[model samples]
Target: MKAVILAAGYGTRLLKDLQGADEQHLQDLTGTPKPLLPIAGFPLISYWIEALRGGQDPIDIFIITNELYQGKFKDWAKNYPFVTVISDGTSTNEERLGAVSCLQLIIEAFSIDDSLMVIGGDTLFYEDFHLQDVVEEFEVLYRGNNQANLVLSYTCKDDETKKYGIVETDESSRIRAIKEKPSPPETASRQACPCFYLFSRHTLPCVKEFLNEKKDAPIDEKDAPGHFLSWLVTRRPVFSTSIAGRFDVGNLESYRLCNKYFQENIRKLNYLQ
Candidate 1:
């Protein structure tokens, strides 16, 4: 399977938070892209590279970044010869092609016709996350039905439902509907879906279809990949696999927390070893 990493976001929020920050370590992050930002002594995206490469089966990995950060990503990618970095030709936040469109760009550019693993470059999961398990689950579902797709979900508190794309799943974990940022009373299900997805080859065409349908719609409709998945659940068998949790490095605070979590975990792991 091929993997596509969406790193095209300009990270305006994070940059804003970094401005005038007192932390000495954070000062160096002024112009860094979210994916390339240092986390636990390593570039955030390196964790993904290591995990994907560690798998027994070889997989092609592609990273999509904006023009502003293309050079940085390309330079970092030199360490991993297997990775291909593509700039979306967007120099500013306003010009970005959005996460879903970036995924489509990789699809069209590479002419990928196999199952795909799509991940948000700024997102990472807790220690319990095992890419192999998710891949195996998707493989089983795909073998049963080629139209099946998989997404990672984590339980969120009722009050936190409004901050996420809540997924309602059936007894078999097949997603019935995806409510985008609905309030507590809007849905009983507390499963919050993250940006990680495994799409079957048969379902790839639906991505283009979704884009075409939303061509004239607002950028919000096309911006987030979750919007596309919410629409896809109605037309395809999109299932959810529960994960421990996920960290989204959208702003400075979240990035700091994510970095601290990894740093602490690494220390504990080393002590045990």
Candidate 2:
């Protein structure tokens, strides 16, 4: 399987938050890309690299970043021989290829024909997250039906539902629809879908078709991967699996909490060994 890490976001909100932070430890984060921000003792993206490397599948990591920070990612990737850094040729936030576009770009640029696994570079999950398990689940679904696509979901607080792409699933747990940041939600389900997804190789062409259909539309049309996913569920059989939880480093409070939990998780694991 191949893994695509979407790290092209401009981190405008994160940078803005950092600007007002009084903590000395977080001061250096003013100009840093969200993925490159340090957590525990290493860059946030490095934890993903470590976790993916620990997985059973031989996943080739493809990190998609903007031209502004491509060199930074490239430098950090030097020790991980399995990783390759690619720039979307956009120097500024306005020029960025949206997450969906960046995903399609890496797929085309790398000529990947295998089952694809996509994850957000700025997010990490609880210690129980196993890439191999997700890959195995995808393999089972794909073998049963080649068109199967999988997405990860987690239950968040009811009030927090409006901040994420809420996925509504049928009784069988097959995803019925995805609602993007709906205030006073359009659906009753609290399944918040993160950026993690597994797509069978046969479903790859559909990405291009989706993009082509929205070529002239506003960038918002393709900005969130959830938008594409919402459209995708209508045409194909997409399913969801619940995870313990995930930490989205979108703001200062989240980053602090995630870093603390991650550090403790690592320390506990080391103690157990």
Candidate 3:
């Protein structure tokens, strides 16, 4: 299987939050992107690498970044020759191609044919996250039904529904529908769908189809990957698996929580070593 990590985002929120930080601290982070931000004394994206490396299935990791941070991502990839970094050729957030577009870009650029795993570069999970288990689950479902796509979700607070893309699932764990930041009291399900997904090779061409349909739409509509998946479940079969929890790391608070948990807990794991 192949894995694609979407890291082309500019991390505008993170940079804005750190605007008044001390000059040295701000200067240190000015050029550094979120995926390269230090966590547990290493780049934040390194955690994903270590976990993926330990998985049962071998994966050729591909990282998609922007022209502004291509050098930084390339330098980080040097230690792990298994990873390939590709730049989307956009420097700023305004010119960014968005996550869905970036996925399509890498898919066509590499001509990926096998099962593909897509993960948000800024997202993290607790120690319970086992890439092997997820892969196995996806394999089982895919073998039984080639059109199946496995997505990960975590229960979120009801009041926080406006903060994420929520999903409703049937008794069999098949996704019924997805609502992006929907109003509460609409659905009893609080399954907050993250960006992690496992797609069968048969479904890859549909990604390009989605982009083509949305070509005339605003970038924001096509930006969040969940939006594409929302449209996908209608056309294809989508399954959901509940994870222990996930850290999105879009803001300062979540970033600290992710680093602290991984450093104190994930770093001490026997398998991780």
Give the number of the best model, judged by lDDT: 1
Say which prediction, candidate 1 or candidate 3, comes out ahead on TM-score: 1
Q: Of models 1 and 2, which has the larger lDDT? A: 1
Better of 1 and 3 by lDDT: 1
Backbone clashes for every candidate come to 0, 0, 0
Q: Rank the candidates by lDDT, best first.
A: 1, 3, 2
* Error in Å for residue 226 of model 1: 0.5
Q: Which candidate should be chosen as best, given TM-score against the real structure?
A: 1
Question: Candidate 2: where is the Cα deviation over 4 Å?
Answer: 268-273
Taking the tens digit of each residue's C-alpha lDDT, what string does model 1 give over 58-86?
99999999889999998998999999999
User: What's the true lDDT of residue 250 in model 2?
Assistant: 90
Question: What residue runs in model 1 are displaced by over 4 Å at the alpha carbon?
Answer: 267-273
Q: What is candidate 3's CA lDDT for residue 119?
A: 91
TM-score of each model, paired residue for residue: 0.97, 0.95, 0.95
